[model samples]
Target chain A: MNSIVPDSSFTARSIAENVQSGEWSAVEVLEGYLSQITQHESEINAFNTVLEEEARATARETDKDIAAGKTLGPLAGVPVALKDNLCTNGIRTTAGSRILENWKPPYDATVVQRLSAAGATVIGKTNMDEFAMGSSTENSAFGPTRNPHDLSCVPGGSSGGSAAAVAAGFAPISIGSDTGGSIRQPASLCGVVGVKPTYGSVSRFGLLAFASSLDQIGPFANTVRDAAIVHEVIGGHDPKDSTSISEPFPSFLDDLERGVEGLKVGIISELMGGIDGISPEVIQKTREAASVLSENGALIEEVSIPASLYCLSAYYLIAPAEASSNLSRYDGVRYGLRVSGETLAEMNINTRTEGFGDEVKRRIMLGTYALSAGYFDAYYGKALKVRRLLAENFDEVYSKYDVLLSPTSPCTAFKLGERTADPMTMYVNDVCTIPSNLVGHPAISVPFGSGNDGMPIGVQVLAPPMQEALMYRVASTLESAEK
Target chain B: MTEPISEKEVSHVAHLARLRLSHEELQLFTKQLGAVLEHAKDVEALQLDGVEPMSHPLPMENVTRKDEVHKMLDRDEILDQAPVTEDGRFQVPQILGEQP
Candidate 1:
């Protein structure tokens, strides 16, 4: 019965069309994914919680809706996983932290509500770095999510589980939040398509805040078109999120297949330098990808934004500073884990010490130090100035180019425990993708080719803010060319 | 360009963050935080004499919403997740010092 639907290549569009037309039932598709999850979940640890019975109930309801001749939304009958940071009413959302181990949100995040309204079944909550803090999923309190492509290697994080779930066919699509390359880096490592939309394009309401200014929820899919389909459904304004753009968003799928003819593409020279620890294969693959676009009528040139060399430094300071403030809500008085102590202040200190992982603690301390009375101007303040300079640098380049191109990561997936020993080495993993987050530009990672140890390499396409449609066109072009 | 973070500094920052840390954690954090700060020195090397800092990428300011009544979460449902509660209020350790 399950063989009716292909396990690995089930896309959201195909499932929705077939279910709506009665060629295949939503229950059948759900069964197919459940079986896949049962088979691969232990190996990958892609999911933190699997809502088996609830998802089955939702699938049955959708089948009835289809029978009644109701018009379905874009995501009808589709099964999607969400990064655990996004709140799901009545479901435990841990953000991969022990503090929220037993916490169930009373309300759904805007994206979750939107997905449900679109007739998509909430399959489960995927794992992540504890509070979305680490470069790899190693910081997850539940456990690390291994790369589906190679179990010994890490699925880049803090969106590793979502990316791995898509790559392993647990779900056709999943939502991930990117703050300094969480989504794109993992999507690249897992050999799937991932997007980090323009900062204000998606509502952040109900997403457990992590460096709120830099975080943006996005989708991971097996195809560029599928990603765009999910993107169109989850984007737009919400009064609940003040940072959300009030402007209307065009359908991303509308211009996705449009080729990048006569478009100006810039390959960032700063990212191409071999001195930055970028593997040779990644560099070669990115250059090859550029030539393919050039042959297809897009004019390509090398552009330099020297300030981007300092992006990681600026991000490490700025993101943690924001995170320190955002995470202060977890005092023992409210929801989440509480460890008893002699007094209120002692209890607060003990609960945090017991609940947060080492990386989370490190970031919190860094933030507190940076925002301290005497040091604010030297660290946090200076990083903000650099952030402004980085944005200006990108704006200057976007004036002459439609999109910028680079390797998604300096290298392909590294072995588990490879860079975990050194925090700085792991931080460098996001060197190529961090600038996009710093400047609030939209970016996507598409698997270009394979590199060392037969692992996949991803090439990132970045466009100016609110120019997601143009970025998708170029991404789709590269995706099709790879095929 | 800046002083390396010390055990005392890590302990002080931990206190500010309300995070209790043991001596071992303090030592480890001191080393790690020092390395991270050392790397951050790159931003200080840049010459930015009079650049305005950008706290957020979007240029919008004072995004005020109209004052209107809307649906709020049920108190019972929200209190369900609280570790300890009494009469619909969160229970916590005493904030004020004990009476002499």
Candidate 2:
């Protein structure tokens, strides 16, 4: 295991280049990661499944292709982990719920197919909050993933496992979904780079639905460039997903190193000042990040989207309202855990009662109540109106600024059970990240600096829809400053 | 807005969700749900007259595809995932109640 310590600097791009040029065989890289996973998996618990044999087989084939003078893909031979919600052919795709524990999909997700076509080796499925419903991975049925930085703290959810995998060097890059900050929040906690592309930029075909309108699959990596590399490969239109954007994918890596000089950046005023529960260290780091951009010749100013203050309330309504309908498919008949009872209705009730976790059940009830006949206009309808106002507010801000910046999470990662007792407190962890999801804008969380207790703090860069290249430019600029 | 949710209301909502909860869970949810809904009252307080509800972030309408048949998942592989299967389909409990 100690033999691969020198390879820690390999980014996804460098790994592919090395493997393609025969400087290092793909098998060697795969073995190095396997060794790291073996050494760190117990304490980190980042992976729900490990595709050791499959990865080795894929690496051997990639090496053989290189010998045959074949053209290689950009991600050729890179070992990438998938969040468990993405369907992988012949692999167990559990959304960290007991219901899908033994079920394996017969087909692959569009992103999975694309990754395979690009010559990337599937490492394994990473863990997530069951159905991606919670801010902490504590809701995962398989158990929580501990933060690699400190084992006592959480890695953030529901993409905790993917972020931890990247930070712990189990893999250079991994894929995770963001529905109201699942990817960015976890990446912030784990001290890695995570991107939530503009909704519809990445095809969502085969991503397990969790608030369909908010979900978007993206990447996690140790560097901005690596995250961009994976993002380009996984993005683009898929006819299979109706919501996928029908335009050609842009070259994200081309503008990555372009720097943020002359770029107009704004600090979201609503996210700053007199906010409860925000740590002083987080505020200082955010200010320092803004200064770094300003000193680099970028223009910075404060902008407000007052309607964003209600985004949390609106998201809690819209997301669960959508989730209640999307998750209704898990009734005891077709697939998943089926608990038998005297009658069909009783069986359906029993199966759900046993299959779902507490947070999931609570959301389902909330959604059901909100969407019920009498309360629909008061709760779900009003939330939708608020959603429009938030979107309009973002539109207004984008008219004046090229990008918006904010602290990814109000505070650094806390102990595992710190806020599990109070759901609202846990929900507040997403306050800064959820607005971007609601507006369908692209956002990335870059590791800015350390906060209290030496835990990593992330600063987010948000851009209007389809402006991922600009977002990456600013992100890479911040990333280079850190280095 | 701070009205506490009744146990009966929690039970009714759980029934609508097809979820069975213990008496303890019912009481817990009644309190928790009340707190969440109380927080949610902020949305209702706004004057949203004439505001159109935005269902999706992207402004797209009925995204229909071309009418062409495509490959589907293998039947046997799909059936293998079901907990109970009959002759080529999922087997479920009888839909009609037993004859009186």
Candidate 3:
């Protein structure tokens, strides 16, 4: 097995293979990742919290299991990072809000529980947009996560921390939640593979809610196969989460090696044209990728979904409306930070005033207004209707096409502060990806090309809901062609 | 129909969300909110006469689990972590009013 190193060659499977075979110990893997975090933490700000001591302790137990002739689980001895939004037992799960800076959960999230049960060591928690709002990770109260490819640019967000962790080699894989474009956007910017599993495919019991209906926990890794490995560990049903699917998880590992030969592929015609702010180079690369699929015995056709143009508009309305209601639980009386005053109203005011970052406060306000009694019929209601139309449109396309493809973002990662003041511009960055979230389908971002600036560009593949196997096969084919 | 946000409305929403905005933040968010909400105008333009509002795409019923006691952090272990706590419970300034 290739020794784990701080480069593209090192991945989760590579590290796990080496660790299990006794060529490397779990401690060596932990120390290697910790050292990388120490070296690159300043450049990427990938981690919100790094508990080296606990990780080493867990690693020791893992090595003991290996030595004691215990049957090792898949991903046994692999070190992974959890997104800050995930509830980690005894770890500060801030969700990037100052309000929850010191609030540790009493229990682990289902995904965290599953990861640990599979024998993966949780190294640390990665940064995220505060409460998973905002397109760029800059909305993090802690500070922005810089891009690993170029230190001055963003790593894409609200999963920027996870993407940067994988890109900078702080960890081979990290788990992130995608409410909108959180997983795929950051993965695109950081040049990694990120999958937002089909909604209802993963349990959301311990995830900090942004838009509950749209949120799904997925994996970020340097390879599609490694993502498949991690997703398999954490993807399943839990009685605690009703929305989790009762349907069986497809054998992603088997599907990944399954060739994409003769697969019917649809390229959204509207995604190629009509969108502004797209780079010509990105369009060219997507076309090249489509051509590669065509040459590989796959059928590629141009399909149109007219409702896609309204995705951003509908998303902004629905996400905020849900966020407004979901976030109301934090009233300075529950878990986390509270600023008290002489009266209850004043206490709520002072607490929220100081606790939430500006972007979070912005969304909360926007959501509150949208869900307010009178406006609900027009704003939230209308958006839900449009969401249904988009879902229907996707069903129509998937009836003809096995999978849909587009550029993950209009361009490569932009400079960190470029669109902070322009929320519209930032929202547009999610144009190609948000439609999937609205439709509650599955999508993955696979790196396609290096732009003129040497930053990575990603092409997205969207699949009908619960059809992750089709996506893995297509993405695996593309990943092979790139190699 | 455009329900353009007024300065008064922005302040009201801020009060509801418990945010004490500076005059600068107020001015900035007012313009920003207007533009953001203006984009919401397109949402009203969508047609859905017979469509049922979907809260989640997945078809799910009550997800309630049995009330069996699972392993949980002991009160001492949990309250030991509270930034502010009293005898056995998490202590906060009287939310409804001040403590005696």
**Chain A TM-score values, per prediction:** 0.98, 0.98, 0.97
Better of 2 and 3 by lDDT: 2
Off by over 4 Å in 1: A1-8, B98-100
TM-score to native of every candidate shown:
0.98, 0.97, 0.96
Sort every candidate by TM-score, greatest first: 1, 2, 3
Candidate 1 per-residue C-alpha lDDT over B1-100 given as tens digits, one digit per residue, 9 for 90 to 100: 5677889989989988999888887888888999999999888677777999999989968888779998999999989999999998999888777432
Task: Give me the overall lDDT of model 2.
Answer: 0.89
Fnat scores for every prediction:
0.81, 0.79, 0.60
Cα lDDT of model 1 by residue, A1-483, tens digit:
011113359789998888888888888999989998998788889999999999999999999999999877888889999999999998999999999999999999999999988889999999999999987899999999999888888999999999999988899999999999999999999899999999989999999999988999999999998899888889999989999999897778787877989999999999998337988889999999999899899999999887788889999999999999999999867799999988888889889989999999999999999999888888999999999988989989999999999999999898899998878999999899899988899999999988857787999999999999999999999999888
Candidate 2: residue A188 Cα off by (Å)? 0.5
By summed lDDT, the worst window of 10 consecutive residues in model 1 chain A runs over: A1-10
DockQ of each: 0.80, 0.75, 0.58
Residue A32, candidate 3: Cα error in Å is 1.8
| Residue clash pairs of candidate 1 | none
Off by over 4 Å in 3: A1-6, B66-73, B76-83, B90-100
Give one digit per residue, the lDDT tens place, for model 2 in A111-210. Answer: 9998888889999899899999887798999989888888888999999989888888889899999999999999998889999999999999989998
For model 2, fnat equals 0.79
Which model scores highest in lDDT?
1
lDDT of 3 by residue, A1-483 (tens): 111225554777877777777777889888988898887787778889997999999999989888886766677788899999999988999999998999889889999999999889999999999998877899998999888888888889999999988888888889999998999999998899999999988899999999998998999999999998899999988877878888797688886877778899999887897666678888888888899889888899989998888888889988987887788777677578788777767777888899988878878888888888788888888888888888888888888899999999888988879999878878888888899888789999999878998889999989998788889889998888887
Local lDDT at A363 for model 3: 87
